[model samples]
Target: MNEPFVRSGNRHRPLSEARARAARFAGALQDLGIGHGDRYAIVMRNEISYLEANLGAAAIGAVPVPVNWHWTGTDLEHLLTDSGSKVAVVHSDLIPAVEAHMPPGMRIVEAGVPAEIREVYGLGDVPLTGRHPVMDDLIDQTEPAVATDQAPPLAVIYTSGTTGLAKGILRDPVRPEAVPGMMRSLSDLFGLQPGYTTVLPAPLYHSAPNINMISAAALGMNIIIMPRFDAEEFLRLVDRYHVDSVQMVPTMFVRMLRLPKEVRDKYDVSSLKSVVHAAAPCPPDVKRAMIDWFGPIVKEYYGGSEGGAWVQCTTEEWLAHPGTVGKPAGGAAIRILGPDRQELPVGETGVIYGRPADYWPDFTYLNDDAKRREIDGGDGFITVGDVGRVDEDGYLYLSDRLNDMVISGGVNIYPAEIEACLLRLEGVKDAAVFGIPDPEMGESLAAHVELVPGAKVTADDVRGHVQRSLARYKVPKVVVFEERLPREDTGKLFKRRLKEKYRPAEGNA
Candidate 1:
């Protein structure tokens, strides 16, 4: 177990104490009649208890399923239902989300122990306190936390649902043994040392830092947890804590660079060793700026929660290949396959597949076996449905998602959802929305449309229709009138041609 891990905001948790709390929590879970192998959903923002819940669940052999903190009731309700998770350990602030669509028979347990979590589910007379039901006194509280080497389902993270409703990436970790394997490539690439202090600005609810926490803790590194990322405060924390490593979405790096020059130089950043960028694509310009400012310290990783996160491109490597995800990960194999599942020749864009002999945790999609078929090539090879090409040097370059999902301002937006809404408008005939690049926003959505014959419609009308149907981020910024959308020989709209036609933010039309 990890010893010297620190949490963000007010609480500082010592791992040994965290281990004790896990034992108590485990006992409390048993009092609720939760048995080994049962799934417990931990739906709280980043905090000390995330560590506790994970450890406590591990202590008792119960599974811990972390809910994505950003997901609303509409989004979260489906995940909890799909995972079959009852007995939610939730944060007081997020009681509303839990209130909306909690499983009918599921029990609600507050997460943080010292404080009374604020939600009331009306099923309680007196809140259940500590393990052992109603014992005023407790024994074995000081019992050494014993961990088994059993490979059990540790946690389940949903697939973000950028393309559709989220599905589970059910994980089975064997006594933190799988931790080192994932960290090995990253550690070796960045030269991470045991004494290195790492600042985790990303949410721990996600896979990147969830695994990073286990890896850093086992290696005896000081893991600094942030409640959420704030660009200015992140720099301040790094300066104060002598932070050596940081991992974030490429957008975070862009936002940090946006800060005033005076603010950027206010802190001493010499302790920074490497910054890992994930979650979305990094524009070539942004990557180059980071390299120029920090000397090739910005590292880019291209992977997904569905097992293959091996494709990586460092800032310096991008300078050479100019946009290529550096050579395949050691012992990890990638093949770019065409639509027919045939291997594509070099310079041909296709779906990238990977099969790593080890370091791949047993990732299975919960409940829906059909969804599982999409990612797995069977016999260990998996693809996350990303489209990309391979250069002569074995480096990979992602073109887009074959499904035409639009990513705007670093957040993913689905065209099918937007198009479905646009079709509802009275004057609309046909519609398609896609992303185009911008320096500020990594990309922006542009909707191309064909109006019903002689029916007048403006961009604002179409934009208004989309905003009402979906989240504000999904709305298109520009709308273009098209006589007809250009199509390939197969009658499919050629998205590459569409993107090339409608560039970012308009250069004076």
Candidate 2:
């Protein structure tokens, strides 16, 4: 029987057999035309096979490009075309939803379907072809137990370019030796003990969760997976499975905390050993509120989708620094540099940069190499265009993307700072800030907010909240309620989407 990684009504994959399955899947891919250095993209929800394919592809030197499952078919097509992917494997259930977006002449594979879609593998429920013509099946597979490959690179995850079209960040596979450092810091932050099972909460296609998943598998930790995020059900599932850890983004944390206190206490979550929060700047108030309820198990990580630029903080350090993203990890060098790429002194804001022991060889846009080399300083450093500052102790605090920073009447406003303050307001549940063209101020600030369920907070109330937390000039001129703010796969707020939807034309304004 297969170890069921997906836990809905059916959770069967035990931790023991997951590796065996990855080898089986790797062999399947090789037989399906995958080879060393080939590129294959996966666009699906959370499942064990996601990890299997990721590591499996790495083993064969085929690059795994995990596209955000929420993207429209057009969005996925961009990734498929941009990455020059040779083949694709998808969830049959989502096929109809994005089938029209698929490009012609692409080889396709499916795991779950109506049994009529020829050549389907009904993931978890059905088995693979027992014998295929692929070479020494076991040898062709990347050793499921070993993932670190400093050379050819692992996977290329695309950023949800809410500010622009998605840009891909290639990840170098981590080694068992590097696992100790990442796991030690992560375990210390999450309060984990030996033999804890962590649920892959965030989608594994993204960097943070992908790293956490592979490390968990190698460390012999049990793994559970969620197909997608559903707040109420997340709590129920946690209680039902007694999950110890999950890679989470702040977006989900706010929704879970907003659930009535009664609804929160409904589950027995004492088994939770740790929770990893990264891919966004979590608000200090949000962090504090969670500590009050869930204890000090939240671990904050500040790293780019690109290889460098990292800062991690634990719940305890977070309580002390409040907004700090902790000190560096992985023996990787971290720095704060000005626009000129010169190292900034403590207290000065600059672009955060990092050079991992092993970094992206050919960094930037896949088809657009010029755009890629633009961010690669060629000095062995990569900056994702985020502007930040380092304090005396080296804790990192982000302002916003260098280009996304808003200037109104000569004062610079960082959208993240405003968004953080917005999360604390009564009625506002989530917020995204962007700059819109303003005849008066060059570029004025605007916000799209998601309100707490049925809270009935109006635009004026939100205005008051922003006024209280920030400078008068920094307040948003527009505060529109959104059923949901557009977000990337990595849980980063898509300020680009908000700006496009609300910004007026140059003359229209």
Candidate 1 per-residue C-alpha lDDT over 1-509 given as tens digits, one digit per residue, 9 for 90 to 100: 34565655646766556567767777777766666778878787666667666667766677878887656766788877888886777764455577677778877675432231221122233344342222112213334335545555656877666546778877656437555665676575444668788887776777776767656765667767766666888899889888888777765776688789999899888788888777765666667777776676877777677664667777768788987766667567788887687789999867878776376666678887777777776557778877788888888887766668565665656565576578678887667678776668877788899787898999999888888877888888888989877532111245565776654456764
Per-model TM values vs. the true structure = 0.73, 0.83
Instruction: Please give the lDDT score at residue 153 for candidate 1.
Output: 68
- Give stretches of model 1 more than 4 Å off: 1-3, 112-146, 172-183, 189-192, 405-445, 448-509
Q: Tens digit of lDDT per residue, candidate 2, span 1-509?
A: 32324332354566556666666666676767777767887766676556666667655667888877677756676777777777776665555544566666666565442221222223434333332222234434534434325344557778776666787765445554564565665455444445667776677777767767766666666676666666887888779878888778887877787789898989988887787787777777777887887788877777666763356778888888878888876555677887676788998988877765442233555667677677765566767788888888878888888878888878777888888788778777678887887889988878889987798888888888889878898788987889988765456776666667666668976
Top candidate when judged by TM-score against the true structure: 2
Residue 504 C-alpha lDDT in model 1: 45
Model 2: what TM-score?
A: 0.83
Point out where model 2 deviates above 4 Å: 1-9, 96-99, 113-152, 171-194, 357-365, 377-379, 488-490, 502-509
